[model samples]
Target: MSATVQTPTTRPQIPVTVLTGYLGAGKTTLLNRLLTEEHGKRYAVIVNEFGEIGIDNELVVDADEEVFEMNNGCICCTVRGDLIRIIGNLLKRKGTFDAILIETTGLADPAPVAQTFFVDEEVRAVAKLDSIVTVVDAKNVVARLNDSHEAAEQIAFADVILLNKADLVPAAELVALETRLRTINPTAIIHRTERCMISPTEILDRRAFDLDRILAIEPDFLGEDAHEHDDAVTSVALRETQPIDVNRFNQWIGTLLREKGLSILRSKGILDLKGSPNRFIFQGVHMLMEGDDGKPWGQDEARDSKLVFIGRDLDAVELKAGFAACVA
Candidate 1:
């Protein structure tokens, strides 16, 4: 008789949802609902600040929360190490839980967390990115978007956006705010909810992540790791319709970051390069910057260049003048 070979069963990949938003944007409320709701699936939650008396821990049900400190107070720079370690350990207990949820600090940029799933081979084998869900404060999101780069990033990276506290704002204001959100991220699905009350079907197991869109937003999705942290960070936004001299902009930004990278936390831009059919996207964390060509410009689309810099004591005039000098 011939010997029979038995094949081992493959374990199903776990789904992970990254929860984020600006401070006081009802993230904790949403978290509480997710944990307490009778969704018939067990979830292991990872939080930035685990056991603080008055914060998320108190509101959540009794469960083990993994706490990790940001390296040099920068989530993008530091989370990779801790997240990989935590997730590696979680895989050992496979089949005990149905999914994983990560709630980031209000100031965090979700890009790094999302990058982890794609960067790590072990984690990638066991877990699949479900979506990035952002909770927004309907009354204050506009102001936050204007002043905070983190707030805008949370919105930009989200696959699902929760416009929380909808009762506090008028219908007209909500409409306008959502319109503004679309300009920043046209692909996300925005849901209006009060006190974060929503059906589980809307958030969990949706499998809404699109890697192609992420590459469009972050040109170097698989490239070098990024890091950041600072006090009194300010933002400068520049927009122009005319094509820019790529050589001039490259020289200027390279010199500027080399000289002043310490003060700058983050810089990002989408450019209409001279004589190019495709859009140019670039992202920088401190001194390290990367860029690549993005999707081709639509025939009817307005060809515009937009850039934003977030840092401490930014000289808006100098940055604007430098960008203006790059116009072709």
Candidate 2:
């Protein structure tokens, strides 16, 4: 006669928040807010290597990445070996952090990252994907949606969306944008924020990842459907040693937007502008752009200009030529 062994009714599972947003959508701002808030919950953050110089990582708490395609060549049905290994190690000393946060690169489709939670038995046993929180640039999401599949997928996969930079847009536009978001992801909770200033409680520990609902929406959330990335969309990183001529840079950018704004999804740069001791940081989505003075150059800091562009059918040579022409 053998006595039945009772398995533990409940096991401790760490809550994870998968944070996503398109380029220049202020994901790092939201992430920084979450980390600095006195919410009494410590989080182990994992950020993707965002820029050529790790500028985004420099703004965040930590960083990491490694992606692979499954045997079936479906890009969406993929996994990150680094993610698994990191989480596995974290699980060993789980008490150190109360939760985990994964901030994906701007161009990333959250499907593969979210699938990691469902596909890995070891990770699944110890971690619960609490929710997918997407930070949207309220001022630019409309333009983004028209040209970016990743942007649309990010919205579709979100459990909560921060309609960030709401103050930048008019109220009527905000209402219309919210209505548009509802059409894409009616189930997600949308919160308006000027700078991702929301209670951590509202965004964290929600236990809001509804797999059944996601399946009903995506049917293939578990990756039965073969999907591939849009090879047409590409990123270009440019570096310039000489300080850029402000007038030349503006004229060139304006002309470029006029000629290729439809293909240009996003653009960002930290510039060493002629006659400015401070760093000029600028980011744009399609025809819209904004810029402001960043911190003054440190005594030992490099003053070289670094720019990145993500778009469809971008001409690297033409872009490089144009950037070179901006040198002061």
What lDDT score belongs to each candidate, Candidate 1 first? 0.71, 0.73
User: Clashing pairs in model 1?
Assistant: none
TM-score of 2: 0.58
Would you estimate the TM-scores of all the predictions?
0.58, 0.58
Please, what are the lDDT tens digits per residue for candidate 2 over residues 1-328?
Answer: 7797745546578999989998778888888788877888778888876632232222234445667755422112456767888888877763688788898889887766766775667887888778889999998987788787888768766778999999999999998777666545544678999889999887898753332222123212213111133334545667788999999999998788657865665566778999999888775545445577876888897678877665667787899899999999
Model 1 quality (TM-score):
0.58
Query: Candidate 1, residue 144: CA error in Å?
Result: 1.0
Q: Tens-digit lDDT track for model 1 on 203-289?
A: 888753332333244212212212122224445567666899999999999888877866665576788999999989876656556
lDDT of 1: 0.71
